[model samples]
Target: MNDLPFLQHFIVLPVLLPLLAGALLIPVKQSRYSLKFACSVTSTILLWVLAAVLLAMADGGYWPDGIGVYLASNWAAPFGIALLVDRLTALMLLLTATIALAVLVFSARRWDRVGIQFHTLFQFLLMGLNGAFLTNDLFNLFVFFEVMLAASYGLVLHGYNLHRIRAGMQYIAINLVASFMFLIGVALIYAASGTLNLTDLGARVALLGNEDTWLLSIGVCVLGLAFLTKGAMWPLGFWLPGTYASASAPVAAMLVLMTKVGVYAVLRVWLAVFGNDAGALAGFGFTALTIGGMATLFFGAIGMLASQDGGRMAGYGAIISSGTLLAVIGQAGGPVLASGLYYLLGSTLAMAAFMLLVELTERIRPPGAALIAITMEAFAIEDKPEDPVGQGIPGTLAFLGLSFAACALVISGMPPLSGFVAKFSLFHALLEVSPTEGKVPGLTWGFIALVIVGGLAAIIALMRLGVRIFWASGDIAPPRLQFSEAAPVTALVALCVMLTLQAGTVFDYLDRTVAGLAQVTTYSERVLGEPPVMRSPQRGLER
Candidate 1:
């Protein structure tokens, strides 16, 4: 497949492939669940392969900026359709595909069979995620954002219940307001800066007058509000925990990736448009991002400590992950962003795997069981705990315990896992690069202190939860397991393990990625430099 002539066109395949598959699945009769499932699975597998190849291609450094720009309909940037990919984009593609495939398989056992609508929206949501990562145009990004959100609405409401319905409506309302702000911000941006193409905005923004710059800043702040809302910042993220907790397990897992998409947007826009190259606009929002991130991190840490609900607990874990990434991006210097990206990969995978496991654990611990388990864990019982050798442990229970521990270790940044590696690297980078390098570096101590505290909070919360699920629940029969359901969660956790083993190679790649992103001119030149795919019949038949 890599040898194929059109493989250079692979940049567009992630977006197109899912769109085509989803569209085709729409007409399949509801009774033909098997066929729909097969198509969805096939498309997802193909997407994974395609993503792997794309990541490899970027690693080859074929483009000077490590960015690949594809002009659609023979059009160019700021004028014609454009899609772009750099190492970051390719990495995002692979991450999306990896998680989507896992979640889809996890659904295959029962969730997919419960309804075919989920099957269709599943692929369409993939399409939206892929497009969002690949597209260079802000308008195109908005289109994909809506596409993703639209599918998410259905997914959140998939297994309708009062809790889900209520959460879905609030999710919709918050995002709709965000979308409205996105539009207003874009309009004001165009009025103030004259371009919506990211590269163009980077180049043109600094040239504006005082009035225009002020207007542009307002517009950018507005636009960023939408992303912050999506990114789940404090105050703006009031809707996230409820919405994520209410979605079906597989859908909730996908929402982990969904949350990162918001972070990705914030990362891209903040770097591309407000970098040191933007003159007066340079470093405009870094302080705000830092404050917001620290606040969100603290909020999430406390929320996790306070919440007993499994789903909401996972949601708060995601919030901590987001806060970490947001704080890193706000740093704007040092070698920390790579560490943040690394953390992003691990936390996203771990959180998703944990969310998937939540439903299975719930099967063993009913509402009353959870209450009982908590009581048993918090209060003392007579001696003679279970056999020290664990003689009576069921295989299913053992597997759950191991998987749950792995996820907890990773999410909490405990030792011997990728999450710890990420946090350690982050602290190392921060220490090496002083606060003077970043505006919010003044708050650098705060960030580091909170990160340590946050990790501690996660450890305590997860440890308590684990005891409740495994130890306190009275002797119970092992729940029935399906290969499809169990494999996905196991695979995701393994991926985090793999990340730990291969940290050096992955960090090198991300280091190269951050270096490429630092050179704003290269990205702009790559997008703006591509010659038209064809010219008017070689200039009217050469006269």
Candidate 2:
């Protein structure tokens, strides 16, 4: 297929459109809610459409190695800013746009009115996310990261309640420290390698001497710490539940993708720069990642079991997903990485849907129900007052209940859903140990046990919470739910069902994505506009 003029510019639009729209929105009167909604929705829909087209083109083999590299301002890479789109990048963009559209639609129903500049902040957030996914330069990655963080600060504090304020403060402080570390890491990398372009850094990293290699490793480790913090891995993740639970539902749903940005960064930078082609630097942090990932999984599992609040349970679910991806990616094996990609998609969708459902379910709960339930349990009251036995469940309550159950199934990795398929694929990949690709020491068994236990923990947590929310409460009036509110949650859950039906096709695409990611040579050549000088031929994990 010939290169279309507009398609050539498609890569930039994801970042540019949102930025322009957000800036344009700043001057608009706050009273013009309809205009703001129209503009935000239009931009998000366009982004989704553009992302879909880009994904198709990249996956359909429109460019070399399924990569579409766009140099900003016609300047070449490693000197000028570059936007590189491959299958993985396109997939992230699509996820971001899809979720953004859903959350925006949900917010428009009423949540947008609670906060000033909600629409504008949302667009800026999209711009940041798209830029982070698309940028090939490290500095630009930092810029986009800050943009994302900045917008998140506003959204987190949206509605301005005491709980939101407290959570937002903690969120801001921790991330500010992370931002500092990120800047330090970027400076160290640039100082050592004389380049900030990811592919150029990848190429140059291969030729580093022992001293330079150690320095770069330090820098990478620092950078990894920052990503880990943002990804909410283990100890760094304590703040996520509170922050997420405090945000309004739409904002909380959108925040599901925030951790993914960190995961994507780790995957992109680690594979491209310190991959096997990095010679002595190969497998620099592999052990740490493996151990850390397992620990994260365990931590998230414990948190899930301990959490009484539904929002916090969903937060732990996100942590568990992040841990699973980290472990698989740490192994650096193609099949496992492919499986991780699938799990990433399924878990993210489930968590987003779960977040939305949390709000809807909570709305229907009787006032002071938690306190009342605690008192009843404390007193060992067996015969609580029961509502009329034959009363039919309200339509809204029934819908929320069904949606809540489906989300629980997905999050718990129950059978006959995408979550089950994802977990099964991951476990299968982990067990398929090959002679050429040795397993991480002590990782195989531990990871398997952790995954199973985590699933069980999630099941227990979700079921307990579900029973409390749905059955234990008595004679509660159903909250009025708008179709707009319910529609997005239903759509997200239905997408998970669709993912189950199309698992085979999705896995095939992921296989291709993993293959492309493993090709350090092709990635470097395409991004740097030159072949790397010190390419290594070794493959698979090194002992």
Candidate 3:
């Protein structure tokens, strides 16, 4: 291991260490506390490694943007596990580690209540997430996905209460279907392409004939379905709110990583495997982007409008953000990619932080109240039941106002925050693609105007709701937050502050990341040898 090159080993360690630690925790005495300690230590180290990787990526420049680092047991592509760390992969790894840390910190109290299995399951889930991000092989991506999903099944159903069970079952069923589709997609892809290693496939996919092209189309569709399902895309996302709503705070926070994995896979595989060849497969790439994205965006917005429950509302918002991210990706060019990177980092961090806040609110509720009110009725519980009466409604309203404001800023892509940066960049991208200088024709302008209008509507709606919730008079009493519970919220706020202050640095980092991905030549050379024959005939034809 010591003789191995640093770059070859660095990427995989983040995945392997946690898995090994989780396995080690299983048989140890007082495994619960020991597991927690192990996870904390291991995750902290991983975080450092992740930071180092990001810095290295930034420094190394985009010269090798699409370069796939192979960890061959000294074996070649068709065999052995390979951990690839391209710009996108590196960014996702940092994000996953960041969120995992926050979730773990928030879960400290629940860890005491839930027992050892929660920690073990969580570690395993993280291992799966990290593995998915770094893995170069498509089959192994599916394998990592299943590992995470299986661990998630247990975590979702951890308490095994009736409500949790019901929700968990639905969640499991939906994901099971997705998993099956994913496997079938992989099979179809293998049949058509004859390889599962992403780099190798990218090198060879252009050589496919019409028959293989049709099969590959089906495979891409199936794979897209699986990713959309996991990412909580519209129509397929009906299960997300209920499942996330029922889970413990930490579990819900951790579950966010699942959506990210799906997103990462789509970006990694599509960009490299397809290598900017947008004309392939009867324009399947553009079709997936436009049709799938619009539907997801509309579904998420409608879901948010329809939601009454607080946690569920946030859950829908998460869906909307995911859709927006994908929409930006589908619309990819220079500006859109930059925007997506910014939003992906910012929104995920924001959502993770907000989710942690909601959990804290549950914990700080009145002493006599159950940690969570299981009754189906709309209820507000508080900490210190003896503190006073008639303050609940006001307090709830205040908290709701804060949440709503953050949500507005996040979803609307408003100024002075990360969300705005993403949206603006995306709009810029649309402007680039539009043929008309004053007004673009077709989907480009259509999407631009629609997204802008949607963002504005969301902002207004959230603001109005915030006013009603915070200012409206209701006799309900308020809950209080302890310092420990407040820690996560404070950490998130600190992150927001850092994001604001270091906006320039953040943008530079994202630009570097995008530049890395957009290097078509680097990608072509790495995957397809010295130079790909740019068929001028293929290049000049417009769809």
Pick by TM-score: 2 or 3, better one: 2
Q: In candidate 3, residue 147 scores what lDDT? A: 91
Name the best candidate (by lDDT).
1
So what's the TM-score on candidate 3?
Answer: 0.84
Q: List TM-score per model, in order.
A: 0.92, 0.92, 0.84
lDDT of 3 at 349: 74
**When superposed on Cα atoms, how far off is each prediction in RMSD?**
6.0, 7.8, 7.9
Model 1 per-residue lDDT at 538: 50
* lDDT computed for candidate 3: 0.67
Better model by TM-score, 1 or 3?
Answer: 1
lDDT of 1 by residue, 1-543 (tens): 223436558899999998999899898897777888899999999999998888887878565556778888867787977898889999999999999989988877477765447788998899999998998888888999999999998888886666777899999999999989988988998899888899888988788999999999999999999999999999788898898788889999999999999999999999999998899999999988988999999999999999888899998999998898998999887498999999999999999999999987876775576568557555533221111121233488788889999999999999999999999999999877864545444488899999999999999999999998888877866665677777898899999999999999999999998998898888888898876645366553110
| Candidate 3 backbone collisions, by pair | 365-382, 365-383, 366-382, 366-383, 391-477, 391-478, 392-476, 392-477, 392-478, 393-476
Off by over 4 Å in 2: 1-3, 368-394, 434-441, 530-543
| TM-score of candidate 2 against the unseen true structure | 0.92
Model 2: per-residue lDDT, tens digit, 1-543?
333545667889999999999999999988899999999999999999999999998999787899988878767788888899999999999999888888988776477876689999999999999999999998999999999999999998887666678889999999999999999999888878889999889889978887877788888888888999999888888889898877877888888899989989999999998788888888878777878888999999999999998888888998888888888778888998988888888888889988888877876677687578557555442321122222233587788888888888888888878878888988888778533456544568788789889899999999999898878888777777666777888899899899899999999999999999989889878877722223246842211
393: Cα error in model 2, Å: 11
